[model samples]
Target: MNQVEHVANLARLQLSREELERLSTQLSRILAYMEELNAVDTAGIPGTTSVVAGDANVLREDEVQPSLSQDQALRNAPDAVDGLFQVPQIISDR
Candidate 1:
């Protein structure tokens, strides 16, 4: 009836006794590491928004590319009309 068990129940998980014990130990170690990191002195350091802070737009130039024709695209359609896909209407005209 620990925090791990409670969380497992909430997530609809059915962990075995051994798995629960192992996870509890692992979670404890992870929490301890976080606590150790929290004790570090970070007074004069500015918070970094991104890892690549120097480059604002790190992307390639947008180029117009040739694509498949209408016939090629609609070739796999089960039902097509006027070069477009035809599907069953969900809403009725009231």
Candidate 2:
């Protein structure tokens, strides 16, 4: 009956002696805010890319567009013949 009531009775949870005294003061203030984020310093930082690092290799211009004309691409076939497109009998002419 101690360590947060032995972790609220191995988590079958039924807290309320004021929610185990307010969850042990909110788990010691979330472990003192994770020990103040384990003290940061990030030295010699060179891990950056594109905070507007645009225009380093943008080249586009090989143009050749005009497609679709074989009778307006077989004019939406429901089963075309001489201009092709009639599929339905999937496998087994064995």
Candidate 3:
């Protein structure tokens, strides 16, 4: 099997022969580009974390706010018991 077929199997994907061939060529080109990037020299350059210029915090302050009561919150629930929303059991005891 080719590299694309192996990768598809690992990802649990069922690709056709044509798709495998196409992906193989695309993956080869991507890897070749990565190799070319790896060959660049950056001895005196500083590493960059963000491409944006500003380092300011852009978030609002966290403050206490009034929220809905139990009845108001559970008013739109399809299933509610006591004061909480109830969901169907997903796990078995077995």
Candidate 4:
């Protein structure tokens, strides 16, 4: 089993021979580009977390405000029981 086949199995994907070959070639090119980038020298340059330069907070401060009551919140709910929104059980015991 090749790297692409192993990766496809890990991701639970069922790929044909053609797809696996194409993906393998693409992955190889990407890895080659990464290797080329690794050869570049970045000695004095500081590592950047964000491209946008700003130390100040751009968002407004959070303020406590009055919210809807339980009844109001449940008013538009499709299903409600005992002051809680009722949703269909998604998982079942096999």
Top candidate on lDDT is: 1
Better of 1 and 3 by TM-score: 3
Candidate 3: tens digits of C-alpha lDDT, residues 5-93 = 88899999999998988888888889888898677898898888777788566887798789998899999999999988899888987
Clash pairs for candidate 4: none
TM-score of each: 0.39, 0.21, 0.41, 0.44
* Residue-wise C-alpha lDDT for candidate 4, range 7-75, written one tens digit per residue: 999999999999999999998989888898777799898888777877465876698879999999999
TM-score of 4: 0.44
Q: Write the per-residue lDDT of candidate 1 for residues 1-94, one digit (tens) a residue.
A: 3999999999899999999999999988998888987788999999887888585976877887799999999999999999999999989999
Backbone clashes under 3 angstroms, per model: 0, 0, 0, 0
**Cα deviation of 58, candidate 4, in Å:** 3.1
* Deviating ranges (above 4 Å) for candidate 3: 1-17, 63-94
Model 1 residue 15 CA deviation (Å) reads 0.9
Better of 1 and 2 by TM-score: 1
- Candidate 2 residues 1-94, lDDT tens each? 2898998989889888988998899998898888975587658866566666563877788897789977788898878778888788789799
